[model samples]
Every structure is written in structure tokens, then in C-alpha cells.
Target chain A: MKIVKYEDIVLKVKLACLQMTTDLPQDVQNKLEMMAMQEDGQLAKQMLDIIIENANIARQENRPMCQDTGMVVCFVKMGQNIQIEGGLLADAINEGVSLGYEEGYLRKSVVNNPIDRINTLDNTPAIIHYDIVEDDVLIIEVAAKGFGSENMSQLKMFPPAAGIAGMKEFVKQVVIDAGPNPCPPIIVGIGLGGDFEKAALLAKKAAIRNLDEVNPNEKLLALEKELEVEINNLGIGPQGFGGKTTTLKVNIEMFATHIAGLPVAVNINCHAARHIKVVL
Target chain B: MATIKLETPLTIDKIKDLHSGDQVLLSGIIYTGRDAAHKRFIEVLEKNEDLPFDVQGQVIYYVGPTPTKPNQAFGSGGPTTSYRMDAYTPPLINKGLIGMIGKGKRNDEVKAALKGHAVYFAAVGGAAALMGKCVIKAEVIAYEDLQAEAVRRLEVKDLPLIVVNDIKGNDLYVEGPQSYLKEHK
Candidate 1:
């Protein structure tokens, strides 16, 4: 069995939180650069340039790229052969989040309760998803998801009759309706199949996937390309100032579903798509 | 496009001269508030009490900044989504709030209120670090308990913005997209 100390996990999570908040991922930065060159509108081009400059400034100064440092979401793959010593895995991750936010001077955005609306102060109790795997290693993928785009996400449990065409239309409508609110030049993640919650989780995962990575599924890859073109045609542009680049990329993930149910979820991510991964 | 230079406590004549899609470099003192602080502002108004600051001809930026590090005037500060504060905005606008700096769309009532001698400007959302450099000074003036959502008085120099909504009811979000669609078609 492979043994990992609880404090080790805490340190990794804390560093990931601090690093991801300030540094724009390389793939996202590349996509932004490419889009900036392709944009037809002067305003759109200017906005993209400013966004690139902002990323550079954040990196140079080690400052949070955006004021909304976001709620930390961690997806963990834990092997059955691995044993965590010192404390529970969840507790370790939460402690790391609190320390990371405090030490990095990141905003404590979490509220203790939705209704009560009081600040948690430490940005604790990160949203964690666990998957047990056969390998003896533990992998943690972290995403700092801002709410401007999160608020724009939507899910639909469509009947079987809705089909691919219905799904396409639904995705298009979601982006159209979102307009300027979610901060345009967005990344779209589509999750198809499974039940409601699973689809949403899949969409969230898809949203944080690296832009340069290729999808192994040929059909879904083609669909992603088609949707990208269609959405850009909507002319939402950078910051919705209007241009050919409304979305930087469209990523889709799918799974098998019940015969009667065709569930779909869409998660929109702003240009500051912040995520990082660590393996131990 | 020529960039317009603007100062705070905007006049009616200045607001009327502005148009949708105009780039602006703003300077002088402005107040900051987002969801929680805006709610408190409304509550205070409902109680027939004075606001933490005078609203007349002043601009309220919809932002909740991160905590500042040593030797910095402010941390990464950028505009939040403006639509969330739409419900509370019309009342503030009616109380002589002449300008707003934020990102994204405002509701119809807020747009109408803009027609009543106000303007809405959109800063590049998510460009917080770059935006922070423009804030020469920041101090929390009210709702200290709200933490990041506290009302702050900020002095900014050459803070970049785009006029999204002008007093004549022009909306850049609508026109900018429509124009692009037309040109491509």
C-alpha cells in the first residue's frame, strides 16, 4: 500500500489554491491569444489585449487575477491501495483552503449559509468529488470557479424525443440568453446523458478541461467543433462587445443514460478559467 | 475610437454628451458597493436614514475587491456582474446617483433610470489586477461587517471603461452585437 501523509495533502491543496488563483493556465492563455488575433471588431481585440495584459500583471506580481477568487472545487482520484494518515481527507483539504485564502490574501467569498448570507471568512469547506481507482496514486484536480459564469450554467432533463438537434438548440439558446452577463468570450462545457446531477458534474469537469487537449471520442469532438462555430456566429464577442469569438472553445462529455431520459447540462466559464492538478 | 477623459461627480451636460461604445478614462473619487452593501443601502433608505455617502452626482462602482497586500493601495479589483444589483439600482439612481461602473447587462428599470440623467460604464470583467493599478487609494467607509462587500471610497486615475448605456438610452451591448452581425451578413 502507498501511504500519504494528511499534512502533505493539505500543503499540496494550499499551494494549488494560491498558484491557480494568480496564474492563468497556459492552454487558456494560448486560446485567448489566438482569439485576440482572429477577432474582427476593434473593441473585441482591445478587450482581449487587456485581458492578456491582466494575466501578465497578475503573474508578475503574484496577485489574484480577478477579485472573485472563486469557490475552490476539487476532483480527487484516490486509489484503494492508498492510505491517508493523520486525519480525514476532506478535513485536510478544507484546512488547506482556509490557509491558502488567508495566506494568499484571496477573497473569502463563501457564505456560511445561502439564506443567512454571512461570510465564512476562511473560504473553507471546498466542494470535493472523489473517485476510487485501481492505481496506488492519489490525484487532485482543482478549479477556482467564479460565479459570474456559474450563474449562467443550466441543466435540462429532456425527453428522448429531444435528440441531438434539441440539445444543440438548447445549448445555443442558453448562450444567447446569457448575452453579456456571464462575461463573454466564454468557454462552454456540455455534459450529455447520465442522470441530472451526474450530467451537471460532467459539465463542470468538461468546463475545466484543458483547451489544448483533444477528446478521444470522435463523435463528441465533431459536435464540439460544430457547436463552437454556431455559438461564435451568435456574435457575443469579447465581453459581449460583439465579434467572431464569443466562445474560446466548446467541450462535451457524455455517458450512457436510461432509455427514456436524455439529460444535458451546460456550464459556462469566463476567460479567466483557473484550474490546476497535482499527482502524488 | 477616441478615448474620453472623465472626472467624478458627473454633470448632466457631460452625461448627455457621452454615447454608447465610447471609451473612457475616468479619474477622481467614486464609491464601491456590490450585493450586500447595496442591500444595506436600500435598507437604510427604507428606514428614512441618510446613506453612508451622499448619492448626488456620484458614481457607484459595482465591485468587491480582494484584500490588499502591503505597500498596495488595493488588491485585484474588478467589476462584478451588474445585473445582480439591478433591483436595488433604480432607487439609488433616483436618489441622484449619476454614474455606475460595472460589467454585464442591467435590467430595463435600471436602463430607464439611466435615461433620468445617468450613465453606465463597463470595465473589462476579470481584469482585476490591471484594474487595481488604477485605484490610487481605497478605504472602507461603511458596512465593515460585510468584509469584501463593504462600501469603499476609492480614488482612481485613468481607470479604463466603456460607456455601455448613455442618457439617451443607447445600449452598447445591443448595438455592438447587432452591428457585427450586420457587417458579417
Candidate 2:
């Protein structure tokens, strides 16, 4: 069995968080560039230009891409053959998040309690999801999910009779109702089937997938293309100013559901698309 | 297609002349507040007490900027979603708040209130780094414990904003898209 120091994990996690938030990913950059070329309305094109310019400034100056530095979400896929040599895994991750937000000059946006709403100040206790893989390598993905788009995420437990077409309309309506609120041109992540919780998780995973990545499964890939075209046709455009390219990407993940269940959840991320992954 | 330069302590007369879709370069001091700070401002009003800062004819920008680095006036500051503050907006407009700067759409109540009274401006939401460049100074004037959500006074120069809602009830959120759809189709 291989052993990794807890401190190293913390350091790596911090860098991933900072780099992902500070620097817009290449996949997102290229997608935006293409969208800028295709944009019809001059106003929409100008807004896209400003977003591109902002990404450049954030990368050059090492500043955060947006004011809502967002909540830290760390997805860990742990290996069975490895042992961590220090404190609790979640604790180390939280420590890294706190330091990363601090060192990056990112905003501390997390509150201590839902109702009381006190600023935690350190941006600690990140929302972490874990998976146990059958290997000796540990993979971690740290993402700063700003709430502007997160607030627009929706989950619905539909009856099996709702079918695939129903699911598409539901997801599209969420984006349409969201309008300018989620900061379009947004990325749409749809988790088509599963139990309630799994559907939500799959949608989030879909949202975190790189904009340029292709869904491995062929059927889902087809569905992804169909949904992507449908969403952009809504004419909700960038910043909801109206034009082509309402969404940069639409990714879908799926799982088997019970006979009577067809749960669907949509997770929306704005053009910023801040995420970074590392393996050890 | 018109370009306008506006100063603070805005009177209804000044904002009334503006219409939806006009571009404006705004300068002077604007207050910053989000959901929590807006709620607190309402609370102060309910208690019949003065707020930490004045609101009359002042513009409140919905932003919670990142922390500033050394020798910087501010960090990456951009407008947040506006509708979150919808419930708290009319009260401020009633208190002579002349302008609200944010991204995204406003609710019916807020739009109704803007008629002949106030205006809403749109700043590019995700363009934080570029927006921060326009802010010449920033200081937290109230609710320090709220951290980024605290009310701040920001002095800006040539801050680019588009008139989203004007005094005559012209709404870009609705009209801008309608025109675009027509032109493209």
C-alpha cells in the first residue's frame, strides 16, 4: 500500500482551488471564443468580448474571475490500497480550502448556518463528495461554485410517464425561467435518471465536466446534442440579452431508476466554469 | 445608442430623461450591498432609526467583491443577481434611492417602483476583473462582520452600465430581447 502525507494533499488541493478559480479553463476559453464568433447581436458580441477580457485580466493579475468566489466543493475518489498519514481527510481538505481562498484573495462567501447566516470568515467546511474506487490512486477535484448560478439549479422527481421529451422541456424551462439570473450563456447539466439524491449528484458531476469533453456513452451523447441545440434556441442569449449561443454546453449523466421513477435534476454553471482536478 | 455621464445624489429629474438601452458611464460614489445588508437596511427603517450611511438619491450596487491585494483600491468587483434583493428594493426607492446597479432581471414590484422614480443599470455580471478596474476607491462603511456582504462606499470613474429600466417603465430585460429576436429572425 502506498502512503501520502496529509499536508501534501492540503497543498495540492489549495493550488487546484486557486488556479481553477483564478484562471478560466482552456476548454471554457475556446468555447467562449467560438461563441463570440457565432454571436449574432452586436450587444451580445460585446458582452462576450467583455467576458473574454475579464478572463484574461483575472488570469494575468491572479484575481478571482467573479466577485462571488462561491462555495468550495471538493469531489474525492479514494483508492482502497492507499493510506493517508495525517488527520481526517475532510479536515485536510477544509484546511486547504481555507488557505486557498485566503492566499488567492478569493471572497469568503460561505455562511455558518442557513438561517443565522453568519460569515464563517475562513470559507471552511467545504461540501465534499466521496467515491471509493478500486485502485491505489486518489483523485481530487476542487471547484468554486458561485451561487448566482447555483441558485438556479433545480431538481424534479418526475413520474416515468414523463419520458425523455418531458425531461428536455423541463430542463429548458428551468433555463428560460432563469433568464439572465444565472448569467448566461450558461452550461446546462442534466442528470436524467436515478434516485433523488443520485440524480442531483449526477447533474452536478455533469456540470463539472469540461465544456469540450464528450460524454462517453453514445446515447447520452446524442441526447446531449439535442438538448444543447434546444437550449440555445430559447434565444435567452448571453446575459439574457438575446442571440444565438444561449448555452456553451449541455451535458447529461444517467443511471437506472425504479419502475415508477424518472428523477431529473439540472445544475447550471455560468460561462466562467471554474474547476480543476488532480490525482495522487 | 445614446451615451450619458451621470453623477451621484441623482434627482428623479436627471434619471427621468434616461431611457432603456442607453449606455452610460457613471462616476462618483455608489454604495454596495447584497441580500443581507439590504435586509438590515429594512430593519433599520422599521425601527425608525438612521442607517449607517445615507440612502437619499444614492445608488446601491449589488456586489460582494473579493479581497483587495496590497496597493489596490479594490478587488474583482462585479454585479450580483438583482432579483434576490427584489423584496427589499421598493423601500429603498421610496427613501429616495435613485439608482440600483446589478445584473439580471428585476421583479414586477421593483419595476413598478422604478416608474418615474428610480432606474436600474446592468453591468456585465461575469466581468469582475474589468469592472474592478473602474472603481477608484472602496471602503466598508457598515456591517463589517458581514465581510463581503458588508455595505461599502465605492468611488468609480467611467463605470460602464446600460440602462436596463428607466423612469417611463422601459425595461431592457424584456425589450432588448424582443428586438434581438425580431432582428435575427
Q: State the iRMSD of every prediction, in order shown.
A: 0.6, 0.9
TM-score, every prediction? 0.99, 0.98
- Model 2 chain A weakest 10-residue run by lDDT: A234-243
List the pairs of residues colliding in candidate 2: none
Candidate 1, B-chain TM: 0.98
What digit string (tens of lDDT, one per residue) describes model 2 on residues A1-280? Answer: 8898899989998898789887999999999999999898877888899899999999998888898888888789998987999888898899999898889888888888999877788888799999998879899988888899999999999998998888988998999889988888898888888899999999999988888788899999999998888887777788887777789999999999999999999999988899898787
Best by DockQ: 1
**Residue-by-residue lDDT tens digits, candidate 1, A1-280:** 9999999999999999999999999999999999899888889899999999999999999999999999999999999999999999999999989999999999999998899877889997799999999969899999999999999999999999999999999999999888888887899999999999999999999999999989999999999999999999998899988889899999999999999999999999999999999787
> For each predicted model, how many residue pairs clash, with residues at least 3 apart or on different chains?
0, 0
lDDT of 2: 0.89
Instruction: State which candidate has the highest lDDT.
Output: 1
Off by over 4 Å in 1: none
Candidates' DockQ values? 0.90, 0.84
Superposition TM-score, candidate 2 onto the true structure: 0.98
